[model samples]
Target chain A: MNLLEIDTKKYIPKILEAVIETWGEEYRYILVEKANKIKNINYIDERGILHYHRFLENCIQKYLSLKFLEEIGVDTSQDDKNLGLPLDSNTKEQMNQYFGNRCIFSPDFWKDAKGIFAFDKEVIEDFRKTSVEEGQIEFLNPLRGNSEITISNYEQFKQTKEYSKLLKQIHHYLDIYKKLDHEMKKYNKKIQKYSDYVDSEDKRKERILDLKRCELYQEIESELPESLRKYLDLKYQTLEQKLRFLFPELDEKSYIEFFSKKDEDNLETETCNVYALRLCYLRRVGIHNNLNIYDNSKEKYEECLKQPGTQEFIPSFELVDKITRTREKKYEEGIKEFIFTSQTFLENFGQMDNLEETKEYVYNLILNRTKVANIPLADEKNNYPAIFFPIRPSYNGILDLAYIHEFIHALLYFSLYDNRWGSGFDICDDDPALLNPYRLNKRKYERLNETITDIYAVKVKNILHKKGIYLFEPKELVNEDNSAWNNTSLIVRKMLNPFLEKFHHEVILSLVTANYSILLDKVGSENFEELNDCINKVDYLIDCGLNLENPEHKPELIIEYKKEMSRLEKIYHNMDNRIQVVTEAHK
Target chain B: MDIRRIIFIKKSPFRMEYLFLLQLNGNENMIRFTGLESRTDKESINSKVVNDTIVTNFLEHFFRIVSNWNDTYINKNTLDATTWNIVIEYKNGKQKEYQGVDSYPINFDSLERLIDKTIKEIGGD
Candidate 1:
């Protein structure tokens, strides 16, 4: 017969005594959680420190000790009776293996915390003292006689009945309930009183405030023209959230008014690209759908060409918008001069080709030999690579260049320790928020991607110019050259203002308190500054916009940025791939 | 990318809607909102068959911002270079490069302020 099958009629007294002694003082709190039978307050905060409740810990310890002592099964203990504990094979094995018939468990122990000891001092000391040569110390523990007590006998023995008084005493706590109903009735009377005063002098002031709130909501609900208001409000709340990012201090009422009014005012000029590339990418990756995305995007694409210098390039946007801007000439003239100059410069440098396809790709995204704007770049979760031009015209040049850069980004992404989602090609889904460009992750990734792109754009522009492409002219791609890229680090640092407002108070604190690592991924040593700037300032972030756009000091973005930056920094340092090598090299 | 050039300019309860933003690579890296002026109504909203230079010019203006980074030679050594301009070409054959006279070289910190100004002016008084 199993040990649990033993007749509890004999040894229960000893078992009960062991429980009482072992429990010491902590019987109330643990049982409180199991109070379905008792029905106490569920109103107490679920978030209070659980382990600190000594009463609860004691109850659990009592339960565990009773079971542990019963399993050890001492001398007929009091009347040929044997206390039995239902120890499954595994628990029995654990008991027999290291415990050697003597084990004292505190019930407060947690496991598997590494070289980092997370267990209490008693548990640690027990583990240390019980090992090998010191195993005899386990027998010397104060609990050595724990199994000798009999719980059943204690319950029946008149001499030990005094010990059960506390159990009865606990029931008296129910006395409070006698008046609880009366108190609740009193509460109802007060509520009635409050109702009676609803129209009184002081109540009128309160009613006025409530009326104001209602008026505000009604105004928000019915403020603008129907169709236009609906469209604008929906966009403001759902798609466009710039107002929220810009004015985090604005109250809910102010926000509705600000955005609704801004919408009313700008709805006349409102031109959101209903067709987003992110939606397109998500669909292609099989994570989402955009039904008529191609049709929609194609329209926007055509509209783009009607602007200028986009020429016939239709695949890449960055090449047209960003890459070619570093040159000296207007786009048309610049491309021509670049082809002519690089043809000579590369020849002079002993290379054998002209930058023809490169020029075509450059002319594809942007049209000028000047500065760029609103360039589109993409980063993904899984390796589900998107065909991003980053700007316009998606030429072989940009297709090639951004491809390598994106590939590097993809590699760094994989090295991430805290991936909130999946790992391969389709790591990212179409972000509903990407279209707004203010999402935390989206903004960070875009800035990181673009700053790196700027590096190449400046590099490519310089090499082309060094080859005598200046036959057209030279544009400053560097800040020293009087360029925005020249001082962007400082601007991105300033953009970090809003991060400060949200740190200790909300978002980050919630994550940290829950022990979820949101930004603890492996970032480069160089990027530590960007990380600190971004994080330390989270408390004040609402006061500022989401981006680090304050305090004109240039921050080392590579340092403060969080990610698998070490690997990326290595790639950034060792990379020698050009647009051609990158695009063509990747199958 | 892979854009189509057909657009519908505002006419009779309908106007060409262009998405605009301030680009960082412009001469002052000014935040400017320029979009494709509607050309023709060829499935205007969602077609990618942009086969014209006029629409292409609008996009090129964006690149022009990039090109102007070092090409600050416009009207150099003269009073003309002192002012800035915005070039606008209508599919109707009306070409105008308005002297931005009142607004130009907006400080980097205040670019959004400029956009607010432009968006405000464009919206109305």
Candidate 2:
């Protein structure tokens, strides 16, 4: 039966029942909610129909495919039936032959990563110990034990669940090893190619140097004796080796100028262009290796952590308004400058033939930029391939941080690592209490990029201050009317200010190459817990201070901040823990 | 008593379009608000019965925050910006409407809550 043609109203119930049986109530709830949402939409509309079709096509199909592929060891790519295409008799026979008498192993254990060992040390050791010549070693399942101790036999092994689980691990490990090997080979080839290019470049430079030397000799030929000039030509093959061939009567300034001109010619702006071209190649191929590693890490996180959600969050009105205004002001003042800067940036960095086309492309960006909450944005729709910011945030006192912060985001995107500083898991998904004491839904860890950018901005601000350009003064207390909650904002800002003031330069310097995920992971999970604890504790202190009846209590809290250095010490120590360490223990 | 005055501005970086739907009880006049300074009489596009429960819930939510609404919330640098300013007149001649971003009073979280509830009760567009 055609999957799309199946009446969803009739089949959804059956699918929900199966999902509930296998994955439990949570999965069923999610599935039902999704299904009902789609069913309500008028599918007569083309877009509506497409959405409905996609929902049915992708929903539960991945799991079902994995099950089928595992049961029949036959390659699905070779069979039309497996691909949901019209069946052929020869392929059908091949499929039957493949399935017949063969063990239909439980693929879910491997595919879903439900198996006990995820690259377990003991399992790996056992596998390594056994050879094809020595025969297979007896392996025990971590979840289950052998009631009757059994040795390895291909047919007999299929009867035990452990065998299939082991096979799954083997398959996974083999795939990873293969991928790693392929990458290593590719890197070797790149290194070799680079070396060859460098060698040819050096040879070319030698030829150029010889030609320049001959030209220089001719320029000063009249100043030299005929015998001396002939002897000078025979003395040197390369210009750089010696300078004794120069005429004593020739002006030293002229000789120096000539050599400097040659250097200037060699180090043209085109040198940067050559490097940029190399960077483009490295970004496509070499950077892809890093991306794979990043993907693997992300997959591991997905397996371990809950899928982040923002359903519980209602965005803060005050914060949203401020952010909106910040962006709006940026667009108002920065649009013209942004265009000029973008044109210059593209001409310098981007390889292009037509200047007019580049301007037109940029002009379209200005015209087509998306607006959200009165803030001009270049989000999903009308998104340019390159980092094209038509509007930049205007620099206010601390708002300059937004300018530098956004610029960094653009820089990171084009960067080889594609260091996504602005992109992260929805902070609203996390518990409100885990972040800043003032704002309930502030995302500190997930918004690591913003923090880093803020740190960088502070560093830049300090340098500018030293040069007599005072951007803005750091306030000890928050402006009551400006914030949603006055006291909370004041306390939190004061608490964070010291760290930003003291460690700004050092922290920014350290994080030049590190991406958002790397920075967070390296910072250690303990620091995050400590941060959460500190925020909670500070909140407690602030609440105590805010008691209207107890006038002395507020004074006491301020005194405590000055006197009680213990909390600050712990927090500072926590902040110091950005270095990565090997510590997690395996069971 | 019907929708007395309806003004909405859909502004993006690319384009800005304004729509106003106004109705009078006896005269039976309809006008489409084009710009801040311009209006066109779109006589064919007259008011319909917007007495549905979902619409009522939206109106109620808007009225709750009417007092807090800012008179002039102008922003020139926003992209994909949407604002709706709706005014409804009752039989007693009392009028209430919301004025906020994205065609709803987003400043008041209650509007979103109400909308979500409405969607759950009766499926949304």
TM-score, candidate 2, is: 0.24
Predicted structure 1: lDDT: 0.28
Task: Using DockQ, give the best candidate's number.
Answer: 2
Clash pairs of candidate 2?
Answer: A330-A394, A370-B79, A371-B79, A371-B80, A376-B78, A376-B79, B12-B80, B20-B33, B82-B102
Cα lDDT tens digits, model 1, A295-345, are 334455345436443332122333222222211112234233333333222
Report lDDT (Cα) of residue A153, candidate 1: 47
Which of the numbered candidates is closest to the native, going by highest TM-score? 2
Q: In order, what lDDT does every prediction score?
A: 0.28, 0.34
lDDT of 1 by residue, B43-112 (tens): 1332122222323233322322321222122211000001233333333344323332112321111222
**Per-model RMSD to reference:** 33.9, 34.0
Which stretches of model 2 miss by more than 4 angstroms? A1-402, A409-452, A468-494, A497-506, A515-523, A529-587, B1-125
